[model samples]
Target chain A: MTDTTEAFRLVVVSAGVSDPSSTRMLADRLTSRVVAAAKERGRETTVTVVDLRELLPELPTALSSQLLGPRFQRAVDALSEADGVIAAAPVYKAGASGLFTSFFQVLDNDLLIGRPVALAATAGTARHALVVDEEMRSLFAYLRALPVPTSLFASTEDWADDALNGRLDRAAHELVLLMESGFARAVRNESWKRYQHTFGSDAGRELGIDTDTDLMRLAAGGSLVDSEDPFDPRTA
Target chain B: MQFGIMSVSDITRDPVSGYTPSEAERIDAIVKIAKHAEEVGLDVFAIGEHHNPPFFSSSPTTLLAHIAAITERLILTTSTTLITTNDPVRLAEEYAMLQHLSKGRMDLMLGRGNTAPVYPWFGQDIRQGLHLALENYNLLHRLWREDVVDWEGKFRTSLQGFTSTPRPLDDVPPFVWHGSIRTPEIAEQAAYYGNGYFANNIFWPKEHYRRLIDYYRKRFEHYGHGTGKQAIVGLGGQAFIAKSSQEAHAQFRPYFDEAPVYGNGPAMEDFEEMTPLSVGSPQEVIDKTLTFREAFGDYQRQLFLMDHAGLPLKTVLEQLDLLGEHVVPVLRKELEAKRDPEAPANPPSHADLVKAKYGDDEPRQPRPNANRGDNVTGGSPYQDSEAEVSAYPTL
Candidate 1:
């Protein structure tokens, strides 16, 4: 599939806190290869990295009062504009780190519907290898995001393995194809009204106001009585 | 440019003193606060209605009526009166009675009380809140404007020939303001009926409310209320003032840290930056408040959140002294000078309403034919009605 547009927007969300953290490395690997894969298909791409560490200070206020601080607002704007996404989180205990899960959780539902996301996770041991598929995939699924089938996992041992690079290539190729498929663009452009969106949700993008509804009819000083079942106060 | 105080009616503990005002004490103190607001030359005093604890103002009309009797010229109102849970018929009756009792010194701001449990307490579902708010206001709007309303809607039972009584002061219904933070439907509804739109510009960022306000203004003009710039608008913000910026911060910090709903969450500075909360000197408050006019445009009312978070009555009164003595007077002159001549200088009072309905003529005084047992009259209840025949043939 080929897009007539000049460049695809690819966003990477990384929950890795420290410099050169494995979680971030896994996301970067996907990011670089996705750019390469898009080039192979003759498509240019622009990448934006949303470091969860930079979002940490704003998360509390966002959760508490639904007020997006500058950082969260920027992240939401970036995520909403992405043509494809790469979400990479570190494993803490058995689940994704709270920072990673929280960043996704705070986003309004339907914000990412139909967008292709490539999932990746890193942990200290091989026991954490299943975190991407078993844990992180479900979260993306709940967000209505389409996760590429080749979920990337990197334990310390797997990082040096050639198989890890193979999964990255496959995922990157899959993401580029999904982006070219124009499914997410179609959903946003065509079928967006079919979804139930709260006013001001989706980073304030869902603003279509239909004045023909019953509620709107009533709001405009119209009577609530329908002709089919008109209420006759005199009869009652 | 009407200046006032709008409280959540919170009974929060003094984080610094470790004492919570009893409901009785807080309720008693609220009247004093409203009276003091008038004494300090503030123009209006509004309270909220809440069924849950930590909030004492369950019945706002009662409180406002009492304040109306004791004070003169200070407009009494609610930060919001729940239009969703309470029967709008009852709202029409009660606020109309308050309107008459206060001698046209009162008004209404309606909200869809979305506190989930409170909805069920009134036999309503929170999910249907917007529908209820819309349909109920559709009915409430008529209840005030029309002598009798025959209506049926999804949420409430059908009403036939129902006349909410006392019939409004001077045949003029109290003005209504539709309050919302984010809901476009609420804004649209306000525009649809040409009602005043009140944005509780306290928590969210200024741009957030700014966008909604602009939308409301555009829709208001679309609905033929007025030009976009002349549409009636009100703002509810939070502010704390002292003579010096340092004193203001030092006095308000503990209250901010432990305030209900947002305490222990974001730092005060961050909240102030994100929201329109002004905490500083009177000049600082005026400077911050002046920006609201720039952002929201020429508008009618500006109400502040000053009494919540359990600041003792003494401190609250003192804050009022500073606000009255130093703040609102200057705000009045500055905002007055900047106000567009075409935009309304104040929200419609009962006198303005009476005049609108009947200019230089006597207002309609409803003389009831008879009660007809439970207000179900065969024809129009008032002498002014010229139906000439009953919709139902009399027995």
Candidate 2:
């Protein structure tokens, strides 16, 4: 079932504001490490980088109206389609950048559910390093994405040290292992229905309703219940 | 197909004039606007139900009943009557009474009203919105169809032998349209009940609604209502039309830019390109509307939002003239030509529903059996047999 010929799609979303920002630098480093890890396992990797700054103008409108313009929609599509996510945000005001969080906020709640995501954050000092575990992890948890236990946080001082690279390597390896093992796809395939609420769903019908139920029968305009027998002779 | 306009009944400062109509003025204007809808040759005039400020249609039945009295031809309906907050018993009685007053010139679209705070105000929890909507509508359905209903549900108190009166005119409940913007469950609910599904086609792109309508059509057939193409579907549209495309844009731009709903969000051009909104000549409006058929297949109703965003009544009337005289007539012929011969050409009207229910016989006119102290113990609540009562109108 493992198709080594298929290219794994990795979407790197960087929320750094400046052109020479360290956040993008960290994101690029993580993507390369993950790509190399996949290559070692005989899996080709395709990377798409989404810079949050390009979409800042559209975020306000997207936030207010729940309508995403074409550019923002393309970025969202890339993230949703990715086999794995490399998310890096610059910490601001003791939290992730508003642009970083808002982008994910407006996405469909189910888009990222059960997908593997590697969390990374860049800040001015070591004190804000906890932003990765405290903020980004919780955000991905809410989205139901699988965040590997290895969360990477890079600060100004950490950049000068070799420890940042080791953390990146560990997180990248975890993401590659999860993506290669096909755990995300398996979970999604097997349990997607569990996450969704469909109309006239079994759960909904089971809530003190049945074929003899006047509303249920009347809703179908006096038709016989066919929910159970899909190949009913009448329709067939 | 039925073509009409639905208004949110928002009162806002007219961007061009810097004037806002008083609640009294706005209310009067809406009545005049509805009457004009008939004068210009439209089929339905539906109004939104809102229980908060900036919106004046707190009581849609009162306004719709008034519109019914003035307009002889137009069908009075709601863009949506709140199915989540309002009591099903009250909905059953109030709408039934409205049906009698209008002489069966009415139907209603039900929705779980979108405002969050409104839930608690009506003693409902927003978290339980879907459950409340499902349970309440189930009860409302029974209240209209059954003479006396004994029911228990999660959202509301239990009912035993409860009878909602002014029993639906001619023993036929008003045709129901379940309106939803994006909820597939609502579409499924609509399909499950064999009711009409109305897609509020404003704000969002066509693809968003296409999926919902497609799911509804499939489920409509799956539930044995009709073929997918024959399922009842209605779409909400927005248009600002003028003699020329340029003038339409020039005139509507101010309102489009600053209007409350999507104002300052997407530019008018982008919005028009994306959604069903049209701001152009009558031909442009027609061209855009025809594409809806291409997207959602043949639908039964097309309602436009013509009166919101502080556009004065006069401008709305002018837009209606374009819609009635230029846009709708052409659409009616074009859509008819394209419709499948077997598919229903119009939504079920009061006359059609009564005829379907009673055939050539007289429709039911319930005469309550002389104040039985308890309807539960009585063998039959009405003086006449069910069949006899149903035959009274014909006699």
**TM-score for each of the candidates:** 0.95, 0.89
lDDT of 1 by residue, B1-395 (tens): 79999999999999999998899999999999999999999999999999999788899998898899999899999989999999989999999999999999988899987689998899887877877788788888889888877777766777888988979888888899999987778888899888899998888776666787898999999988889988889998889999899999999999998889799888888888888999999999999999999999998999999999989999999999999999899999999999889988998888988888899999988988755664445567887788655456558
Number of backbone collisions per candidate:
0, 3
- For B88-198, candidate 2 gives per-residue lDDT tens digits of 999999999999999999999998887899988988767657656766787888899888888865556778878888899988999999988666657767988889999
| Cα lDDT tens digits for candidate 2, A47-106 | 999999999877867887776787787887787678899899999999999999999898
Docking quality band of candidate 2, CAPRI definitions: incorrect
Q: Which residue pairs overlap in candidate 2's backbone?
A: A219-B193, B362-B394, B364-B390
Q: TM-score of the candidate numbered 2? A: 0.89
TM-score of chain A of each: 0.89, 0.84
Q: Which CAPRI quality tier does the interface of model 1 achieve?
A: acceptable
Model 2: CA > 4 A from native: A196-236, B386-395
